[model samples]
Target: MTVSDEDLAIVAEQLGRAPRGVRAVAARCPSGHPAVVRTSPRLEDGTPFPTLYYLTCSRLNSYVSRLEGAGLMKEMTDRLATDEQLAERYRFAHESYLAERDAIEPLGTTVTAGGMPDRVKCLHVHVAHSLAAGPGVNPFGDEALEQLAQWWPSGECASKVKN
Candidate 1:
């Protein structure tokens, strides 16, 4: 997986900073812009960066932020305690995430992103995972994405950033 210079530039603008350890554009929006990126397990400086799939689109980030602001994290966390099937699926997602990251470079830690299996720490992470890994992978992320409106209809959020 290789990220083109154009994609990298767009992502940098989306993040408002230069992207580090971006291995590939894992997912793209409807308008063909980068939405999620697959990053290296460690930084170039050897720092452990466990976030494998990072969400870069500002519009998607805003939608996830809105969900976070609405206390969706707490609600999902609470549901995990009672929903055995959902919990099991989330645990699988966590394990898969760890495996993918370790395949790149072992971080020597079991801490997967988005507080998987036990909690819903960040909707952004979950949404990123869902977008990268696909549906039925991260239950919360799939649900949250389903709940949010189609954001790309307005315009490409990162279009002007590149121009």
Candidate 2:
């Protein structure tokens, strides 16, 4: 779970800057590179950071952006409104995210990233949470991950990056 120097290098390459409040490697790509990072609820400077799971792989980020641009968020939002079971599950995901973040340090905000419970604002956050928490935690996130193509053609993203 620890974020190693190699992981940091790859994350830096992914974000194009040094990441802050990164506590652990949340999830890895199929190629075994750091894909999602778990960040602290509060930053070093005492700023509240609600995003607990951060997506760090650029390729995956691009793919998720493409999905977002294609109106996937609207489609998911519509489904969430009509599908009671799906909505319930998504609510649980939001609660789980809040619980985890509160455990780290309470942000005192009900807003979980990616617009959980009511809408789908960002596929990137949902996918990161799904990848980090594993399947069945976030239905929308699980769907996003299912739709994503294998981004790491060159194997581990850390090894592929030039630091």
Candidate 3:
């Protein structure tokens, strides 16, 4: 889980700013550019950062932001109100996320990011979680991935990230 200088540069380019508390590239695009990043449980400045996995790809971020703008989060949250199995799974996902983050560095807080175990707030966080941890771990993340189209091909960054 080492983050190379080139990886940081590529991620910074993808994010359009310097990323904070980023530990490594947790998930890469098909073109091998960073899609999601694993961040420190706490930032260098001593801020408690609960978001473990962060989506970095500009294209994916834009798509997920569009999903948020389209009210998909409200619909998903509505389902959580009526779906028992899904709610249980989401709760488990939240627990797993918290446990993983705690393993890295115990923050002593139960609050995980992305509104897990209750409501869907950020599709980008969920999707980044899904990509970092893999499928079946995060139900909301999985659902968001299912809805997003294959986006890597449209914005290949091999040239920009050439070593």
Candidate 4:
């Protein structure tokens, strides 16, 4: 999908700056605002940006941050150490992310964002990946998304964007 001017404006409002190397709108809010953006594996400056799915919705970001502050990452990490099936799925998610990124341009790195397969470091990245790739791709991301409040209750977050 093409990134429209409105999508750019919404992402700028969410990130406080213009986004670079945005490939497509990965996901949108209920009100049709850009919530997650699929970014290029390599940036315009030739920098290897491993983060393929980027969350651009401030409301969702704030909510996910709150979940992180609540020590959810620790709980999830502990579970990963014990749950074999969950760990396997998480590893698949990591592999999937790596494959997608490599398809764009090989970064020669195994470091997938959000600390996949081993630990949960950043909920924002996990949640973004989950939202972008859809359900069943990232377990941690699905869990984080489940914990978020109704961030778009009033409508799309873009409606709340200020000039």
**Of 1 and 2, the candidate ranking higher by TM-score:** 1
Question: Number of backbone collisions per candidate, in order?
Answer: 0, 0, 0, 0
Task: Give a tens-digit lDDT track for model 4, residues 1-163.
Answer: 5687778888888899989999999998877889899999889999889899999887788888888899999999999989999999999999999998899889898988888768988888999899888889999998887667455334556664545
User: Which residue pairs overlap in candidate 1's backbone?
Assistant: none
In the range 1-163, model 2's lDDT, one tens digit per residue, is 8898888878887898999999999998767778999999989999999999999887788888999999999999999879999999999999999999999998778988998879999999999999899999999989887777454334555455655
Cα deviation in Å at residue 81, candidate 4? Answer: 0.9
Instruction: Assess the local accuracy of residue 161 in candidate 1 as a C-alpha lDDT between 0 and 100.
Output: 51
**Greater-lDDT candidate between 1 and 2:** 1
Greater-lDDT candidate between 3 and 4 = 3
Global local distance difference test of model 1: 0.89
lDDT of 4: 0.86
Instruction: Give one digit per residue, the lDDT tens place, for model 3 in 110-159.
Output: 99999887999888999999999999999988888888856533556444
CA error at residue 116 for candidate 2, angstroms: 1.2
Pitting candidate 1 against candidate 4, the one with the higher lDDT is 1
Best-matching candidate per TM-score:
1
Write down the lDDT of every candidate, Cα atoms only.
0.89, 0.88, 0.88, 0.86
